[model samples]
Target: MSTSPVHLWGPVRRAENDGVRLAFDALTEGAGGEPLLLVTGLGANRYWVPDGLCLALAQQGFAVARYDQRDSGESTRLPPVATGNPISALFGRRGAAYTAEDMADDAAAVLDALGWGSAHLLGVSLGGAIAQRVALRHPDRVRTLTTMAAVPADVSGLATLRYIRVGTLAKFARLRFPDTADGAVAAGIAVSRLLASPSRPFDENAARADALRNLDNGLHDRQAQSRQIGAQWSGPRIDAITRPSLVLHGQDDPLIKPTAARAIAARIPGARLRLLPEVGHELPARAWDTIADELRTLAA
Candidate 1:
């Protein structure tokens, strides 16, 4: 069996400003649908969204573009951040080389590279925050905005939202990324089971496969995640987003309280909210259709 990751995503490409400055990996696929950009959450890995979800969106007439953000997945790594201790990063004390605004700029650059004047932007968790920034900064590039399990600003300030789950953070801190591929799969299974919706059964085998794919790419840097978290927490309120918007949250989300979704809906003028029963922070395979249907309605 081949461990190579490139085969999964055929015809990988990179988009950037002049001379590979701020360059990142992206793919534009699907047909007969409007242009849509799917932004990944904190991990910022396009692969994390699951191939099935992307394909479903594409099948629903969305010309979907998926990509990785800086210091994440296969994208460019900016200056490094501390990792061994993982405590400073836990508090988001680590300085980041870039901000969520910077990441949003990368998304706009991606649109320019793909020759798209604008596209519907759908983001999950941290990616939702980035999408909001993209709409605020480059209004012309976003046709519609849909955010899932995301907060309007930093995780701490929002009384209804949570900044971080300390217990989960401690769990990750204790985990050591094993050297063997099977070890990586096992590790991923363990984490997925923990993050899966309490109302549903987690598919350990599928989680293992996805984890193995991500592991083949590289380990996520905790410091980089800290910087992203910092930028997200430090944002000016997203009251200026005038784009037609949809905010979806799992009624049973543990990581991000459902109240956070309500807070975000209240902040963005003319935003619609949908609460999925028994859904959690992670998007279960079964929930993809409901999400896609909402996107279709939003697009219309």
Candidate 2:
């Protein structure tokens, strides 16, 4: 069997959003295919998205790009404010830094920087929520929307908790490591292992390599994660999204429940929902091609 082209990631580029600078990188320089932006999960750097998935999508005729959201990775970090705990912040009414609308605008800014009029957006975890907001806030700039292992954008407070596995979140507090580059790698591996599917063998080697390569992984920043989760959305609901939408969630996802995806797909008119069995919060290498194929069909 012929293998897919290995996507060579371009150097990190900057996209200015207001005063904040968002960091992003394209799959390669000259693919000239459909633009597809991959939004990373909460506090995750662009490297969290597997290169294998990007390669698979590239083979399917997508010019893939991934970006670090505000307060994550190389993106501009706002001054820290008092955010008790990230878990509490997830249920908080006010954001310590910015609104979710501002976060959505950041995606538009990246698109403007790339000079793409509109592009398909594929987001996972917290990124999925941001992608939905982007579609609602900047409908004209999105061709299609895909969310993986995400909750409904409209739900918040106690309502949001219904879709989350509280026990899994508690594990974040238990993660203990020295505050250093090596610690970041260790934390990354712990988080990755925690989110990996129970049915599959966790790839600690690959995770270690990725963590070492992207030493700026923001897994240790609880307050930043707080600000990210605490950012409230005042815009139209996910049902207001008019673009083509797909909601994919892992059947065995230990973070957000598959019901969250179902809720999203049900709310967004004509949105397709796919619950991958034996999968988890993290994207396993085995499911890369299947996801890419689904995205290809969505773009078509």
lDDT top scorer: 2
Q: Candidate 2 lDDT, tens digit per residue, 1-300?
A: 012244477778899988999999888843699999998899888877887788889999999888999999899988776874688887764455999999999999999998899999999999999999999999999999999999998788888888988899889767767779999889888888888888887778977876777675478787688889889889898888999999999998988888899899999999999888779998887789999999999999
The TM-scores, one per candidate, come to 0.85, 0.95
lDDT tens readout by residue for model 1, 1-300: 112355444465677743233333333346446888888777446766766666667767787777777766667766665532434543545465556667788888888876789999999987888898888888889999999988774344323225445576567556655557766566567656656788877677777667766663333345556656655335556788889999998876666677778888998999999999878777777788889889989999
Candidate 2 worst ten-residue window by lDDT: 1-10
User: What global local distance difference test value does model 1 have?
Assistant: 0.70
Error of 2 at 178 (Å): 2.7
**Candidate 1 weakest ten by summed lDDT:** 18-27
Error of 1 at 24 (Å): 6.8
